[model samples]
Target: MFAIVFILLLFSTGDSILIGKIQNSTIIDVTHISLFNITLNQCICKLITVSGIIPAANYFPGNQSCQLFNFNNNSSLISSNFNTYWIFTNQSSAFITNTSITSTSSPTTSISSSSTTTSTTTSSTTSLSTTSTSTTTSSSTTTTTGCTNLGMFPYQSTYSVGVSPQSVAVVDVNSDNKPDIIVANFGSNTVGVLLNVGNGTFLSQTNYSVGSAPESVAVVDVNSDNKPDIIVANTLSTNVGVLLNTGNGIFRNQTTYAVGTQPWSVTVSDVNNDNKPDIIVANFGSNTVSVLLNAGNGTFLTQTTYTVGTSPMSVAVVDVNSDNKPDIIVANSLSNNVGVLLNTGSGTFLGQVTYITGTNPKSVGIVDVNNDTKPDIIVANYANTISVLLNRGNGTFLNATTYLIGLSPLSVAVVDVNSDNYPDITVANSLSNAVGVLLNT
Candidate 1:
């Protein structure tokens, strides 16, 4: 009697050539393997034992059914194989096997392979179980090497929001520990809040009317009530609207505060260090930024307007001069440059220091890109490039270095996505409908 023994192997990143691909060919055999109800490792191990050939397959846990399409030798999932994974909306997944048994010995030879698949809820680690059957050789199993079998989609769900949402903010409006989605619907002139009900699903959106053509939205705990409130930049109405969260994701009627003409963006921060959040708006039409100081109870004490370059589309509040005082960084759309307004003290900003950027600069982002402890500036220019200006610690910036990304970059964001400790850049290219990422080495 011949006993089949499976030997598992591990491949490193350099051994990618050994991985297999499913070839497109005429179907030769259609086999359904559903009898083995076991772990993913044992399932694929047994699968190769029976078929001796890899095939295109689909598996679902809902019915515990798996269909394998076998074409031929050339029809093998790959020229000759590792493991291939296919992801679906189904809870379970299917695999395309690519292992070749070069030669088979008689009764005592080990004939097995190990595969690791990851699931959303749980990840099972596989160990190489090399069962030796030779009488001269003592039977041994390597039980310590764990392979991460990854099958993840914790929240592979999607929900519908309103049409033409210009901007969004995520906050725990209902204090559920789950962040909910809030959007400014530019088309409908309303701010929509979709409360999270845990596990990636959100309740129906509740919309509150703001000003006409609301372009941006920000969330902060206004009125010191410890609840997240909503602030929207209504461009057509040339004002900022505040909607107080009346508990449980509900908001009261909006209270409007007049600002510069065509307010395109808004930000919330304690610019004055008063322990209260203030509202800042970028008025595109007037080439000005409005700073509304927070009076007691989330109310504003009128806005103080600051002169910047023409067509200031976006504004960022950060200490550009390393003085610990929050300054203002504005991306001037018409002037094709970025201007830094250093805060003198107590929310008073001095004249702007201009730094040239690419044509039609649209947005500003502050990041310490070079690990220099000083915050750097990133500008998104509509002329198909993004400009980086290194800060010189004292208000001024070095020359701009432009990186060609794609068509019409309208917004820029900086983050350390790959854990390399170096900051990376993400740009939203409006002309291409795709986002471009620039990773730092």
Candidate 2:
């Protein structure tokens, strides 16, 4: 019953779908996810679908242990070490004997419904080739949320994207609650949209042509529609392009707004409190930042430019001074520092003040580090370090406390990794080719 065995591995919720469960093994909690339950599929499905996380749920029928695993990117599935082998027991009998095997969903999906003995004579094994499964359907479906955890693990998969993909933003494009990916494909001169199809896989990437060499992408409802739209900083085109989400995952053609030279990054915020989203872009070549106030109906006035440090490559919006209004933060790469431009009333900003970072800062993020209501700054420096600059009450910041993390800290984000309520720092190390997570104490 390879056909029947394959149908029981799928896990699905409202819109959140697990990639697939690891074969027919009971979940061994190797990831130390202290989920105590006598029922098998209910606990794993609830843990995966309701948890908003895609942690690897490995199945080990023996002892009913659930496992969590980590795999590197661009690798194949390794089973003997990782324990993801499959087994298709003869299901003609009502009960399984000798071995430990568990399942999350009902197995009636692929079984014969005509007669009681009809499935009893079915062949139970198929050619699942090299991997350790006795006989399994390779591409079949079942109600499963278990992710593959071998090389990059099979579940944390990679989509063949356009060449030289740059900045990426995640949002639910379709009405489904599943998150989708929007990436700026710089080398291919387009934007790639990969939508989740509730199976472990995604629909083929839908690529939309935009301005030349799009470097960064952001999502916002620019036209006041609830549907989110795509915006990209076209570096070579020296402009910003907007792709309105017509409905579903579809988008209209590129509508261009000229900006400074080489707009490397872009972000959106309501700068004037007009309830409409505005665009902020970092012009790398021009050494300035442009604020495009959303005029009406997805259009912007001539950009209002503000001077910043040399080669401002990244832009972010945060209330850095506790002023309730959104302020701007830019990483001036050539200047090796970050510039903070405080917001004045009515879409205007004062002069930018400089704070030193490591050599060549590339990205910046805002988070409340010490539970101090005031937002602090976390910067990713290209020189193999992360700089944490704490806020000092008013609109200023203290000298940064730096940490050596990896080869090249290219990107940074803040999240509470261990559910400890304290924020943690994660970095994408470009040179070392790793992701480092520093937990908060």
Candidate 3:
């Protein structure tokens, strides 16, 4: 008796995909013991068994499944002969009767010959399991190795109030190119303004109370005065507080506007096509996204209130559906999904697409992860882990791969810290009281 084995292997990568197969052409005649020259094809390699004496005019048949092994050094999956079999015969009458062969041995073979030529080669190969494992290991190692050992263990400090600061925005306010950080103290009624000293360190200048609670902040040229102004959401107050940057690392006289009940997050953008920037607040308590038009100066006029999902915490602007116009992306905290608001480009809401990430996604940053021109989303999940939603660039997002970093990642900031064009993610974890910075090695 004789047996044959065949195997097929398939894999892919971010840039390229591939598929291939290995087939056994000849079955070894082990009854009388014969050996024959097996013509190897460029794609198929004949595997032979060990401890078997080779006889002339015989071909070895693979008795087991061919294992297609992918080598890391080689760009393609390489197949080797390592399977084996055993043959036996029964002597009955005048001569020996035909006997069945069983695969009792593993096919362990020495290197006889190899087909090094390839018909077609792709620029990349995707071994998703290996790739995923490698990626996960590399990320874990990077998290443990690359972070700046600020060396100072974070000791509990008495903030202005016993509130957990969730978000931090750094913007150059004084025209000095040095960014000033404004921390949104979510648990407390106060917001801390840390003035950047241009040396990576910040000075605690002032901590001011906005409303009942402050959640998010954005610095923009709100009045077209060539100066950046601050817009913060007074969440509990159900309004937005506008603070004008005084050009001296200080903000004075915060103006308030009644927008909605329990506004969770606020962003400044040119939403109404008015050339002047407008304020879009995600009112979580009301399940609406409020659009406040800039009134030429530091004040705003109510434009429209569009309904969204529950607990809309973060809002982002992008050309999501590739309609050439900017669209809105809102991260709903309670719903665990990011709502996509298709911009009608005429100051009206057109449609929406809901996508979920990790648990409690509070903040989102758009960055091109796969060298694609389109931007991908990096979600900072508060309840669970971090996730990277790669943009397929076809009005759809690839399933997010959760990257474990730290406890309760509330904020994420991306920049080319190593001068590479690729952006590195640095997350500010609230509960751990440490920054989890991930460097793309």
Candidate 4:
């Protein structure tokens, strides 16, 4: 005589793949008893239950009241009031009991003609089971197809800069959605601009003359105009060069402004929150950061110098303290540390605080590397290493984690090259005569 028993098993969705379910069976002794409760409000809850049971056998669903067997026939069958579902994989086929028979029987399982169904049966009996029959649907897995291996920083292609490319900036020129590149050619006394071709490649580079020995470049919209302007630090000329954008990837001739001696890096931001952008240049020769207040017509007033550590080679602007005011961070190469200048909201800076770093820190970039919402600092040390300083959300940083890179890395830029939602590091290796990319893992 055939006996009918009802059992309910909870299956959650996780990393486990659903195989097939068994129905209308008398459950045997459930030795490894565990309880899991789930509300049937949605299909996601059921998927979660199945996910928890993967790589393991047997799961109890519905309050601690339901008992689920491991599909073994060694124990006696019992009657249950709860509804039960059996999920199995090809490896667990040997343990599955016949669906209609209370006794032990070898059953054969096969993939059904329908893509989503699986069939199982014994020589003398046939039983059908369906795994997912709920009205709620779940999204399929999304994969970034055609992506290169996560850790492989394959060399894409490189364009030749003028003589010595000291620093680089990434921005969209010509209103293109892709990021173009600007390189400060120190030996050529000019800056090179490469328009991105929408793919990973760039168009032929166009060179724009600046003052003597341009060492750094920053792109911004300085004149309340939508077009991005270029700012260059002319190291030997001891001044800052501003090239107003005339639209469509074209820039007017350099408009020079006097600052402290030997300005090695340039960055632009609304320093006083006046809605008009201001310029900040790291003056290496004078050991100061020159703040040039913008006049809103692509011109700036005379610079006000703020003393910083020795030989500051790079400067980055960010609201490090979450104070809504833009602050400054400088990489002091000779001092072997980074200096933080807090914005006092009046276009003036408070006394600087120094954070120790590796030898000859050349460049600094801000990015949220850990997805923590706080901006962290990435520094290129001339001593053959790159350092990552995690932000503490209070304008301070935790200890740095350093990674070895090519020899004499002079500059760094962060970009998401693989569309992987993680920022990768690109370094200009001065002595190596090559650009090194560190793929984010």
Q: Order candidates by TM-score, high to low.
A: 1, 2, 4, 3
For model 1, the local distance difference test gives 0.71
lDDT of 3 by residue, 1-441 (tens): 233233222233332212222232222112222112222221122212212221111122331222222222212222122343222112121221222232322323222232321111112112221111000001111111232322222234333432878566778877778877777787877777777778666665477778877878787878877778878898889889888877676777688888878888888878657788888888989888888878887788864788877888778777756667667778878777777777787766665677778888888887776677887788898975888887777667877888887889887877777767788999989889899888866
User: Which lDDT tens digits does candidate 1 get at residues 79-140?
Assistant: 21123242222112233443333322222122233222212111111121222211111123
Residue 403, model 2, lDDT: 92
The true-structure Cα RMSD of candidate 3 reads 20.8
Give lDDT: candidate 1, residue 84: 25
**Each model's TM-score?**
0.71, 0.71, 0.56, 0.58
lDDT by residue (tens digit), candidate 4, 242-327: 99888888788999999888998888899999999899999999999999999878899999999999999889999888888999
Off by over 4 Å in 3: 1-166, 176-178, 185-209, 246-252, 322-324, 416-420, 429-441
Please, what are the lDDT tens digits per residue for candidate 2 over residues 1-441? Answer: 122222233333343433334544322222333232113554345445444444345543432333433322221222222235432121122232233122222222232333221110111222221222221122222233453222223345779889899888888887688778899999999999999887757777899999899999998889987888999999999999999998798999989999999999999999888989999999999999999999979999889999999999888998888767899999999998999999996899999999999988988989988888888899999999999999997979999999998997888999887778889999999999899998888
Error of 4 at 207 (Å): 4.0
How much does candidate 3 score in TM-score? Answer: 0.56
Compare candidates 1 and 2 on lDDT and give the better one.
2
